[model samples]
Target: MRILFSGTPAYGHLLPLLPLERAARKAGHTTAFLTHASLGDLVAPAPVLPAGASLEETLDEFHRTTGTNAAEDMSPATAGEFFGGIRVDLGADAALAAAHDFGPDLVVAETADFLGPLAAAHLGVPWASHGVGIALEAPLAEAMWATAAARATARGLALARPFASVDPWPDCLQRDDWKPSRDRITVRPEAHESESGSGSGAGWEAPAFPGREHLPRVLVTLGTIVDDPEALTEIVTSLAGREVNVVVALPPSSADGALPVAGAGVHVTGFVPMRLLLQGMDAVVCSGGAGTVLSVLGAGLPLVIWPLGLDKPLNAERTAALGAAEVVGGAGEAGEAVVRVLEEPSYRAAARKAAADIGAMPRAEDVLPLLTARLG
Candidate 1:
């Protein structure tokens, strides 16, 4: 099978796909990834859209659809950026020019890959929603979009547009059990039983960080796009000189010099091989972005979340309530929150259960089989 895949820059969005991507390769199917240029360099090289296109185009469209450019639009923009960006990103994700530019038997992506579904629908080919984040129930996601419409209409801006018409989740996966809907992952064989990709393979080294072997490690990330260094700063200070070891992967800042200043007790890096990082860490204190949360869960570690910016708060709500982790409001008390979560055994217990929940998911590598059967 030939696959054209589009994913976002957020580590949460991209990394969960690695194991699955490798799995497909092991199965001997050709796969190509569409993402940021820098990241494309890190992974197997694939076409990259303009690096800033995601935020730029998304913001432009949000303003256009809502008819708000100045301050009137700022509030909703802060809260609903991801929810609204999908419409603007649709064309690219679906590979409009990209679709014909690179024809594939299938297009695989998360719901955020706005254009993937449309392009697949347009091509009369199969497009599977390879979610790395939470499962967006087709109906519930629609309702959330509709809620955005109400906000737009209240301001007398533009009218609400139809974003999704079908159920986003496949019929078989939908369940009302109220657990964190982690990635319905499928790892390709190259990634499943193999550590080659995690080390040096194909001229790329698997993501890993040094000097963290002996500490009771904690991973704190705010993802690449929606960064909050102030929160990291606060976290380090809170744990200042504590016995526990804390390591943060600050992307976008991409600079070890940009590491969060802790009280000589915390260590930070611009990037860490996340899969390897998660395997070694005891827990994560994050903004609850999807890829990181899913990875941690996939590894069965507890989570202490301080959701900031975009879908994080919403994502936090699901996992925290389900005993997978704990949630702090934001950067304000990030450090204290981390301390509290760690002090309590309940957090660890819940995290264990959450990990088991993730193990139950179908591996992300099996996309072809699932799609073939579903659309057969």
Candidate 2:
């Protein structure tokens, strides 16, 4: 069987599907990824077909069409509309072309890939939606699907709902309102283990900086695209003043721009492999991206989350609801939140429990029969 995967051009969307893609190939199915040009590195080993708009172009068009700033707060309705436009305008052509060329019996995609289901519908093939984090609640999912339906009709094709949903998120963390259509297969979150060591580290070891191992160490990272210069400076400086060891990962573009070095206690650098970094970290302060949040939890580390935008706020809520993390508003509140997570034994206990739950879910490769059954 040939299977094609499509997604938004971000690690948050693509990373969750990696384990399943590996599973399909291990079972001897031909697999390929269709996404924007910018996400090439994340989808390695599997052949990638370049798709629709560039990441920058998609963001610019979203900003232009929605008349909403990506930096500021917006309603879920606006998010739905902006992303629906992405499916219709940026992704459809490339996805259709890839589908035609690959001739897949099945299409499995990240939940955010609006184009995947549409393309599957056009080709009359089976498709499945893979959940990235917590399942979106009824209100949000319904609103987003409403926008998707209109977008599909405008292009003269009806939307094809997934034949099944592959859920990697733990059941306890899911929204109370989430209800799937009878065919939901759950897989364990792979955490950062799958992406680690892949050229990001290229076999580099964690450097032995003096006093780092002795102090109470905390790792802080806002994701690649979303960061606030002022908030980062405040968080790093505040943590440094507390005498805790701080390691921060900054996007390459802004690494030299604004973060003022507080002291030798604070270390600033580019991306650090989470597999290695988690070895020394007692706690995590992050922007609540799904991959980061699940990775930290899977490691049994408590965290403080300050969401910047997109699905982060919702991810934060779900994690905090599970008692594994504290959700803070900004950098000003981060220092205290981190302290609370460390001092409260319950938070650590809860995190460990979630880690065990994550470990208990079915592995991606174990679900081959479910994913490929339609072809038979």
- Give the per-residue lDDT of model 1 (tens digit) for 257-331: 475374333666655556645655777887776666666666767788877655677677777766767787656
User: What's the TM-score of each model vs. the native?
Assistant: 0.71, 0.91
* Tens-digit lDDT track of model 2 for 186-220: 88887544442343646646545586567777888
Stretches of candidate 1 above 4 Å error? 8-11, 35-39, 42-52, 60-94, 137-140, 143-215, 254-256, 260-264, 330-332
Candidate 1: residue 54 Cα off by (Å): 3.4
Q: Residue 353 of candidate 2: its Cα lDDT?
A: 93
Where does model 2 exceed 4 Å of error?
A: 70-76, 193-199, 252-258, 374-376
